[model samples]
Target chain A: MTEKELLKQLNKLRTINAEADFKAANRQMLLAQITQGEEVKSLGYLAQLNIFMSRLFQPYAIAIMIALFFVASGAYGLTISRQAKPGDSLYLAKKLSERTKMLVAFDEKTKARLNLEFASNRVLEMNLLKQDNNQSSAKETLKNDFKNEINQAKSRLAKNQPEAKSDKTNDFKTAGSVKDNDHIDVAVPDKKVATTTNQGAGIGEVLEEAQKLFDTGAYDQAADKLNEANKLVK
Target chain B: MTAKPQTDKSSNKSDRNIFLSLKKYQDKEAFMQAYDLYFDQIFRFIFFKIGNREDAQDLASATFLRCWGYVQEGKLKSEQEYKSLRSFLYKIARNLTIDYYRQARPQASLEEAEEIAADFNPGLIEAETSIEVEFITAKLKELKSEYRNILVLKYVNDLTISEIAPILGKTKGNVRVTLYRALEALKNLTRDHDGEGITKTIK
Candidate 1:
């Protein structure tokens, strides 16, 4: 083509719409890089202080300063830890930070999702802890924590839809079947057994029975039934 | 077309002012304004050169990042330290493009260019124009890198010889001559193609 006509055709080629997803991702990546770099630049003295104190206090002080530095960075460290995986030293910090975030979250839907995410993270943490040969008591404590979080999530969901309470009953039945197949004699407290037999069946039924037990001044049995219901629902 | 000269002069003046503001004060607002102003042009320039969206986005970002890096390093402390932000950015893009070609898998850029041409939908352009555009794009890849680059800067980017000289580190006279030679080479490369309309225009 003549240069003029060639230029005209070249202009047409420019109109091909760039893929939107790539554009958005690239923009975010670049903006994050730029902002992060600017943050570090603006906090140059803190970084210098970190180096200075680390030198003064020797090795242990470095860890202290690093913690202080993370706090000083104002949610940046928390943001970074959101992607932390198992075996990362920051993994527990990530979980704790997420819990703190959930506490401040105003929306019920968001809080529920965050609780579910925390529960998933706990499951991942449990697997990692097991791989590391952590004490059985520690593993049990994490299992309890996961179950509690899942119950909280379910409660929030049920608040949104009362019909979800029936879904919880089906979930509990599945849990009961799995426990039966394992044949592990899970130590049910005496109070829990009394309430479970009286409660009929399912998590919703047990919770309702526990409330009735609480009204009769049988607090121990009520607490036990609540705990049992939590495990069953999950 | 009659108002084009006045518009070009005003744009050139604006670029000069932005460059000065950035150089003298390291003004971030000014830098961002420049970025918003030139991002599309810079992206298109790289996209035209590389013929791939991902690489173009990367190299374009790299170009601006490098400029920001210079600012952080206080390299742009004076106007004399650099010519114009536009030229500086284009220079970075050109160098990065060359680096990409050096490290890139052999013939990958050409293959990508061909893929782009082949994938061109006729709805985007007149059917006849689409074929002509494809033919030119294919021929563009066959040209020597320097010739291909000059043609793109002049025709595709519509940069004047004077504006392009600093970016390419060539004299304006040299840019004009090189552009003419590049156009002639492109014409000769496409001579064998069944582009009667273009052949007549080129003749």
Candidate 2:
């Protein structure tokens, strides 16, 4: 047969539309499964009996339940809080978790990193607030918080001078890192900022500039410089 | 011949919007809409490829479930990525079918294909058409797997060359060439089955 004739004969097969009863049933079942929320209700009578027996152990059971609750809530909160912004309800939860992480962190390096991350989040929150223009007072508070967090991070980095030195050369090797630091430094100007804005410069320069600005009562400018420094350190 | 269902363009767009909503917000209503939109088309595609009703249904359901997992993972974030959902579903179905074949070699028989075709269009297949279908199916089994896949995707499932490319991970030009060669091979294989050959009477 000619190729054209063969193509026409093949096209005839398109008419066959097989019906599978299970297809619809399976789809319904799957959709039902996807839409269904976890049965957070009870595990029924056995679970209730177990809980009642555990409650007889009083303090131990209470401690275990509290631990489980916090762990579960922390996991759920972390997952949902990723999308939260400054004024979001979950934003506070995100911040609380960050604080918890810092408290639990063993090394000064990790603490410094977490502080810088928190300060960065505060900058993002300020940016969002600036865009919304909803709460000048809240923006001011976040700006101050951003400054405080950066100062704390700067202190932490200062305490770990040797590790910070190694990190400066090793961690900030990429052009992207240098570019990011330069971008932040250029956005906010202060003598203290100038001290820390240099590539491979430690947190000492940042703290000095921030302290000078704070002493002069230029709080807003101090906050801006610290925010810029926070971005560099991160 | 039974008339093919007309694809509604607006509904397709709405289905896409629903998919995006499901991906971004985990909206159950949107997911249900998406499930309703593509379920049958995916099942038909799998059924044709696997040539078994039960496995096809299971694989098709698994395909959607896997897609839902991707949506939750935020892998399909953009509209461009979501627009490739059909090809993505087909790819999953294709992989699952391959796995099924690996577990049980030569699982899809001509008789199974005939049975499925008969199940779909019970009254439409007369003795002559049934014999013709059997001959075509028998010859299809003889072709290389790639050739058979292209033929079934093009003819049975009515996927365009463009749509078939991503599922097979080939360029559009490659799909076109493979499809042409596949038709040629099928024709050659079926040549002796009829005195006039399968394609002679066609215009």
Best candidate, DockQ-wise? 2
What are the per-residue Cα lDDT tens digits for candidate 2 across A191-228? 43344435326455665676566545455565666666
Chain B structural similarity (TM-score) per candidate: 0.72, 0.66
True contacts kept of each: 0.14, 0.22
**Tens digits of per-residue lDDT for model 1 on A51-103?**
34533433333443453353345335434444555555445545434543453
DockQ of 2: 0.11
Per-residue CA lDDT of model 1 for B7-108, tens digit only, reads 244445556656765565554444554565566677767776666655565667677767777776877634443356777788877766665664433345
lDDT for each candidate structure: 0.57, 0.57
Question: What lDDT would candidate 2 get against the real structure?
Answer: 0.57
Error of 1 at B64 (Å): 1.4
TM-score of each: 0.46, 0.43
Docking model 1 quality class: incorrect
